[model samples]
Target chain A: MNLIEILSYGFIQRALLAGTLIAVLCSVLGVFLVLRRLSLIGDGLAHVTFGSTAIALALQLYSAASLLVSLPVVLLASLGILKLTEKARLNGDAAIGIVSAVGISIGIMLASVGGGYNVDLLSYLFGNILSISYEEVIIAAGLFCVVMVLLWLFFHDLLAISFNEELARVSGVRTNLISAVLVMLTALSVVLAMKLVGIMLISSLLILPAVSALQLARSFRACIVLAALQGGCSVVAGIFVSFLTNLPTSAMIVMINLLFFCCSCGVRRLITIRNIG
Target chain B: MPVEIVATERLACGYREGYVLEDISFTVNAGDYVGIVGPNGSGKSTLVQALLGLVPISSGSARLFGSRCDNFSQWGRIGYLPQSLHLLNPIFPATVAETVALGLLSLKRFPRRLTRQDRETVETTLDVLGVYDIRSKLIGELSGGQQQRVLLARALVNDPELLILDEPTAALDPETRERFYHMIADVNRSRGVTVLLVTHDTGVIGQHASKMLYLDKRMLFYGGFDDFCHSPEMSSLFGEHSQHLMCHRH
Candidate 1:
């Protein structure tokens, strides 16, 4: 099939739309998480989703119904992690590590008990864009719109809290509420991105683009815009490359994102040298 | 009699571990430039935190602008500069103008858009602090003194009735520190803004502050600068250096 003919396939179209939507949403949210020093929370929540998905598979739930089961579970685990770090005096990293370890163990145990880990479970672990369906695409797109609208409405408050929590509180920004909202949004994005990038490599979607943008952008607004653009570009390009080379879609996307980060670093260094010269 | 801007009655506050400040009591009236001076670990920052309602008050009560601390919601009326701007992530991307604009976030509704008046306020503040030329530069690219001035501009952008600064001049050079004190004094005198400045540099603050608050885990003395110089507590706490530090030429 020619390039246009290959792209005309229904599965390919669904994969592109779903992948791009998840990429943009994750990148924008990633800017705030990266700035607030909570990038690792993405990894933690992704692992929780892995465990929840395993439970769904063990119950023989359908693909669409499985998201229903996993999303709420991930959100609760996200909030639990937040509470543990805030009230329990556990260090943030330690809290994430504890939750992630428990999640991975549960998933491993469930997979072992439920017929010794099938091909279906392996696809979720490594990501298979070819398996994306029309229904999942619609769900991902709907969530992308919701996240974008909410972020736009609360961008100022989010920026204030991300900059300094204490100062934001003193300024009457409702730091606690904003923090909860951010975590919940992150959980939703991680859960949705599970099929796009899978459990193990999901954080790369949430972190790499934002970090790369920060290296080159001069303002917070620029960082968000650039990160989203970078994420969308990487997702589309990675899908095309994966289609051509028959490689794992998630791994290819991550490799592309790493290339962007390296190029950003080089550009920053060049700018610094130019100024000095 | 002038209206009291801040009043704390026998306030005792501390972290979960132990009490850092105990039985602290003081009042700041309108237009008063009260400089709080203390050694490290003397709970100066902690007291500031308590006043701003960032720390829980273990005992007694504190009020701001005639409202209880817990009930006080007029945060826009108060400007606060934390001791360390270093708390901001150095790599977090923000322009000087955008950083200053955050000072006005509380004044607007969610999805806050800058009004013409807000823009004017930001510009005038940056100009006042002599940082308007670099308004578009990233905050991380500025020097220490420039960043301090930008932060000060942010604090002053809201036209606050009460200005609270905690160790604002810690990392500044001598000339910058002197200029900063002068700017603060100008605001207190010309704008009738009540000032509560926390610092360890007794000499510089003593030259500008009308009132002095000496603290060592508790209130040692709170009165006019002249009285602080003559007080027995000042002499005993600071020994011979009290007179030298407090008697510098204005």
Candidate 2:
């Protein structure tokens, strides 16, 4: 079918809406994570979601039910990773590595024991955009609103904490509570985006747009705004390209984001050279 | 009697592993330009953190503005310039103005939007610190001294009654450091804002600070600069070199 014809389908519309919202959510939260040097936490949480999904599939749970099951698990894992790195004195990357390894192992073991890679499981592992439901679209939209509102309400506190946690705390920004909320929001975003980008490429959605925006934006506010714009544009473009090329939607989306990152790097280099000259 | 802005009685604080500070007792009253001097790993930062409520006091009590540290919620009344501001992410995306505005914005309630007065305050602060020219410039693009001044502007924007700085001049050159101290002295004198400056430069303390806090894992000396120069602890800690330095200053 042609582009207009494909747009007529409710599933396609749902996928596009959900994908765009997830992109915006991920990019906004990604700015904070990247600034705080916690970008890898996205990968860790995504892996945990994979493990949770595997368990749900093993128990013959519905897709929505499986997502519900995974939500709390992922949130706990996010907090656990933070505690491990902070109080337990484990390096951030090391903590992420340990958690990610356990998650993937659980997923692999469960997938093997529960009658091999089924169609539903395969779709979740490597996202199938056509399979996105109307319910997920509504859920993604709801989550996008929540994330945006919270980020708005806590923008200054988050910025202060990201810049200097100690000073933010001293300024009475409730550093620990804000950080915990940030991690929880990140977890929610990761889980919400799983269907659109799947486990392997979920972190790309979180890191790429923000990194690209950082290459061009000079201020924190500009960085966040540009990241959201980049993320939203890339998602729409990726979905269109995937529709035209009949490629895996998740992979196509990541590839488009990668392209944006490369272009941004080149632009940044040009700007720096121009300024020097 | 002068109002006690910061009072810690036998304060002991440490991390999960061990105590960095033990039996630390000191009091900073209003309008006091107190310079806290200590060697590396001397719990100077930890002590400041304790007062700011960033670190928990394992023993004794810490008070800020007459309220117990744990229960103190009036952070807007105090300004803090952490030592790590100079070591911030190299590509951190913030303009000098935005960075300074954070000082005021952080104190406001949620959905914190800058008011006209807040903008004026930020501008005046940047102007005071001589960083107004670079207000729109990215913070990462500025030099170390410039960045330090920007951070100072942020700390001053709130009009805080108590200013706590942790080695803020560590990254600046001698000329900038001298100027920075003079600016701080001006703030303390003109605004009646209490200053608690953590530094390694005993010489600067002698020249600029009215009171001195000498720390070496514990309170070695806490008194006027003249007394610190004549104290037995100072002589024992630095031997004859401290006396020589003190003499050279006079």
Q: State the C-alpha lDDT per candidate.
A: 0.88, 0.86
Which stretches in model 2 have alpha-carbon errors above 4 Å?
A: B15-18, B84-86, B231-238, B247-250
A1-277 in candidate 2: lDDT tens per residue?
7878988988878888888889999999999999999998999999998898888888777667787778898999989888898888899899999888998889888877886556667677777766788888888888889888998888888998888887787667888789889999999998888898888888999999999999999788999999999888887888888888988788988999999999999999999899899
**lDDT per residue (tens digit) for residues A91-203 in model 1:** 87888898888888888888888865466776788777778888888889898889988898889899999888888887779887898889999999998888988888999
TM-score of 1: 0.97
Model 1: clashing residue pairs?
A: none
Screening candidate 2 with a backbone cut-off below 3 angstroms (N, C-alpha, C), the clashing residue pairs are none
| Model 1 lDDT tens row, B30-137 | 999999988899999989998888988999899999898977889889888986555567897999998999999867776677788888889999998899999999
Q: How well is each residue in B46-151 modelled by candidate 2, as lDDT tens digits?
A: 8888887777789999999999998898988988888755457887898999899989954788667788888898999899889999998998888888988888
Candidate 1 displacement at residue A180 in angstroms: 0.9
Docking class of 2: medium
The TM-score between candidate 2 and the true structure equals: 0.95
Best model per lDDT:
1
Q: Which stretches of candidate 1 lie over 4 Å from their true place?
A: B240-242
